[model samples]
Target: MHIETQLAQHRVTGLRAQADAHRLSTEAKPPVELRTRVGWTLVELGLRLASAPGPAPAVA
Candidate 1:
């Protein structure tokens, strides 16, 4: 299955997937290394989500 379809089926997306965008961030950590990785993952996911089209409109 395609990624877009997979995302839809799994119900995983940046839009509804995360209740709070803030949740995606890495809380202040002793070292910056952890933050860097979290940031990268967020960015990667954001790009994929952005590229995907929104769900189809509900029929009347």
Candidate 2:
């Protein structure tokens, strides 16, 4: 039973290492094109501007 637990733990550790490596490899290179990046940036800017509060009314 102890040996089985150790083996299972080792397997889980290896799998976690493999997943971390895969995540790091994928993150190392972004898949977005320049056009896509620019588009998303514009979309975000538009959203921010749209949601911004307008100027206050003048007090007479």
Candidate 3:
């Protein structure tokens, strides 16, 4: 199923925050790199959680 618009907005906001954080960094790492890393990290976590087993059926 597709993510809701609100959820998509939230994700976009989070990514912007992450990008901003990297933008403030004085290190050699670039903002684009930070954005990609953070985005991929979120995707990886989501995938892992989605793959996790959930509750099974109860007795009839």
Candidate 4:
């Protein structure tokens, strides 16, 4: 193949890949509000676990 034809094919392939990536990203992501709420819930759970008392020491 000619160099110019090869370059054009490469450009087309790159553009198609970029379009696919953009479509997947937009379609697969959860809504921002839901994501934020879930993130905060996880943070709260982590904080609670961290602050909770440890188990009592085992007797010999």
The per-prediction CA RMSD against the true structure, in angstroms, equals: 20.2, 4.2, 15.6, 6.5
Give per-model TM-scores. 0.37, 0.54, 0.42, 0.50
lDDT of 2 by residue, 1-60 (tens): 699999999999999999999999999987889999999999999999999999999999
For each candidate, the alpha-carbon lDDT, in order, equals 0.77, 0.97, 0.87, 0.97
**Model 3 regions lying over 4 Å from their true place:** 1-32
lDDT of 4 at 47: 100
Rank the models by TM-score, top first.
2, 4, 3, 1
lDDT of 1 by residue, 1-60 (tens): 899898886775665566455555545435569889999999999999999999999999
Best by TM-score: 2
Q: Over all chains combined, what TM-score does candidate 4 have?
A: 0.50
Q: Write candidate 3's Cα lDDT for 1-60 as tens digits.
A: 356988999999999999988877757654578888899999999999999998997989
lDDT for model 2 comes to 0.97
Model 4 ranges off by over 4 Å = 32-60
Q: What is residue 5's positional error in candidate 4, in angstroms?
A: 0.4
Candidate 1 colliding pairs: none
Candidate 3, run of 10 with poorest lDDT: 23-32
